[model samples]
Target: MSAAPPTVFGIARLGKRTKDLTKRLQPGDIAIIDHEDIDRVAAEALIERHPAAVLNVSASTSGRYPNAGPRILVDAGILLVDGLGDEVFEGVRDGQTLEVAGGEVLLEGDVIAHGTDQDDVTIAASLEIARAGLSEQLELFAENTMEYMLRERDLLLDGIGAPEVRTVLDGRPALIVVRGYHYKEDLATLRPFLRENRPIIIGVDGGADAVLEAGFRPDMIIGDMDSVSDRALRSGAELVVHAYRDGRAPGAERLEELGLGDEVVLFPASGTSEDIAMLLADEKGASVIVAVGTHGTLEEFLDKGRAGMSSTFLTRLRIGSKLVDAKGVSRLYRQRISTFQLVLLALAGFAALAVALWATPGGQALVQILGARLDALLSWFTLLFSPRATGS
Candidate 1:
């Protein structure tokens, strides 16, 4: 007898594998992407859509650095077929019903492409190999940082060429949010602070959506405008397009097409959107700047697949004592009362009330009333704690 064929599941949905592709993804659709060294953010967005399977044309974990993306996908029970090459995209049309089994992409009962199946064991091994190459990455990062420091010293030290914006930041706290790692959790944790303080909220790229989700309007939206939604553009937030230092504003075109040309402030600077946002706040004389989900640690920068966080490092140095991480704030700040505390406080209040009533002019009458209530309470307790009759 012939061996049984492998079970195939779900229809295929082909996309460029960019973070922008998350907007079009539907649940249970197999995502075909060309993303190499998929970062945590991209993986997270893809995972949220509940993709049936992921077929990557480019290397998901290229072993250049230990990216958490492939591991995250596999750990979530999502089937990952890594490095199928560009042929997979050429053969698989968008919305085509393709069967994926054992790392083989099948179209109309024929095997179209084959890839390495990414399971826990395979992903772990890849991560180990990637870790070994981190020394080289670190060296490259250090070099890049030094180069950036030399180039951006004027901007960092002197606040040269900082654009003037209508959104006033003088003597006010500014909350700069980025759609990076644990952004939602940080935002939720800082709810009380946001409500009480009402800091000028600045959203970087897709962070605009996050700000909206957190029930706060962004005072300023800053980025290349690639990942931000059209709704967010029309959100009445002051738009600042991050352009090149050479005065080329590509993101301005997006706003112009959306009929927001007149409202936008063109900020031409050579840095990441988060960096620009921080600099803008600092330059405008913000008293304090609280950052949510922005990359700070070395590992975090690497997780975003960056060679180095030159702009981020310089921005922090420029901001000095005013900069604070939302994660740190969330962890250290305690505002909410515990249930145990509430119960204990209630018991203490009842005891204090009894003592006060006994010391009053109507103490005798109050004691009599309390005595009757106590008797009733004892009777209720007796009934509650009494053994119930059970049927055999």
Candidate 2:
């Protein structure tokens, strides 16, 4: 037979980019998967890429890892290796091969290591048993967590936005809040929602950049002291200062720097910027509040590295249907670029290159500079066009 495949290690760290992992996977590349706690949406996206084999980093079928990753991998007829730890991974890299026979794994380590081929029946049966047990646990865990967060929400906001406040203008519609980095991505997804009739735009801190870059202007800004620049704050948008739960207006210091105290609207809330935005829209009786880049899940909260998203989880219920998470809406309204756009853009690029190249003695130098600029522009563009690609 041809040379046996090299053993591969699976990573289980939080924030592990599954796309990156998928890119590294060659056919027959074995991966040690980590984190059984991945959400359904994220897990499905990862599994659709199709890695060869997966070994669960955790034993005991714990719901602590992503439920969907392992479950889908198992169902897709991929190998499911469980209970292997760091040492096992290291051993694989050190030239050991894993062999399973009967109901047990056999491994040998040396300059060149090998493993026994285990019976397929035993492997399938064992994986199925573990999957069944884990799926039940994960479903229960998600249900309980969602319920718990919803209950703990208002209490977390107490002495904060508990009293609530409104600042919407009589003639202005509710502001559509957005953040930077993925401005184009946000705009593309939001344009359909804003077609013809639209919500007044608002910027939270740096979100003003998001607004302007997307060719829109902010009607209001909501945040603490830092992030929002002088030019942005003076953009004639209404300013709302989100204070701490204890009523300490921390951002007031910056507002003083700009001499905007009289113009500031302070609302104390123990939630995030997006949360405050949603609350403001509701309190002001805005018809609807649409948010971009708003945190909507445990993974997002964890990505934020905060101990609790209890406030965000709670604030949603308070707003209920009045609030729309832009992320889900963005996904739904994502536009597919036709092959025509790609072909036309390619032709246009080639024409631009030809013109620049034939223009002057400095044409090549100019072309080099232009190329660099285009690369930078594309780098930024990908932040909107393909977020996963950037991470990879």
Worst 10 residues of 2 by lDDT: 109-118
Backbone clash count, each prediction separately: 0, 12
lDDT of 2: 0.57
How far does residue 346 in candidate 2 sit from its true spot (Å)?
20
TM-score of 2: 0.46
Residue-level lDDT of model 1, residues 112-210, one tens digit each, is 999988887888898899898888877877898888888777878888878889998999999999998888888988888889999999999999999
Compute each candidate's TM-score over C-alphas.
Answer: 0.86, 0.46
Candidate 2: lDDT of 221?
85
Error of 1 at 41 (Å): 1.7
Which stretches of candidate 1 lie above 4 Å from their native place?
Answer: 1-8, 328-364, 367-392
Candidate 1 whole-model C-alpha lDDT, 0 to 1: 0.86
